[model samples]
Target: MDDQTRLELEAAAFRRLQKHLMEDRTDVQNIDMMNLAGFCRNCLGRWYQEAAAERGIEMSKDEGREAFYGMPYADWKANYQTDSTPEQQSAFKESFAKNVENQTP
Candidate 1:
């Protein structure tokens, strides 16, 4: 219930989410996730990078993406990324703006 324990629990849950995305959600592209959930693997990586910096550990965006994706992000994109439809792209743009506004801290 302390701050340290809460952080550990949150980190563990994040790891499980990453594992699920990598292992069970191969069909779900980042674009679709962004359009629907307003966040995706790349966002998760950025968050991971921020968290590492908060602890004074310098982790690159690429390193964070690799940890989340279970492979190099470029490799994952080459192998898994599908072309987004125009509708999906439009929805993503709208959702992205709202998502950003909601996350202002």
Candidate 2:
């Protein structure tokens, strides 16, 4: 496939993943996703922000999150986020250390 087609396909896949998480699976907590998959919706937003920076677009973290979540982060938390159990928090610490702490941006 050509470069434009590849980019479109990747964007479509990302949109599908976003829909799956935001619309289809609202019950999946961010902390659990971090523990299990090492990334979550917030991470996706951060990546979106970073990509905008790379292209000279000025997008704040909150803006990126709103763009991805389709609402304010606080609102999303109020609506969908649940408190993490101690076990989940512990696992998140280890997972974050392994997957996110050492990464250099």
lDDT of 2: 0.94
Candidate 2 regions exceeding 4 Å error are: none
For candidate 2, lDDT tens digit of each residue in 50-92?
Answer: 8999999999999999999999999999999998889999999
What does candidate 1's lDDT look like per residue over 1-105, in tens digits?
899999999889987898788878888988888888889988888777888888999999899888778789999999888989999889988887887546843
| lDDT against the true structure, each candidate | 0.85, 0.94
TM-score for every candidate vs. truth?
0.82, 0.95
RMSD of each: 2.2, 0.9
Mark the 10 consecutive residues where model 1 has the least summed lDDT.
Answer: 96-105
lDDT of 1: 0.85
Pairs that collide, model 2:
none
RMSD of 1: 2.2
Model 2 sits at a Cα RMSD from the real structure of 0.9
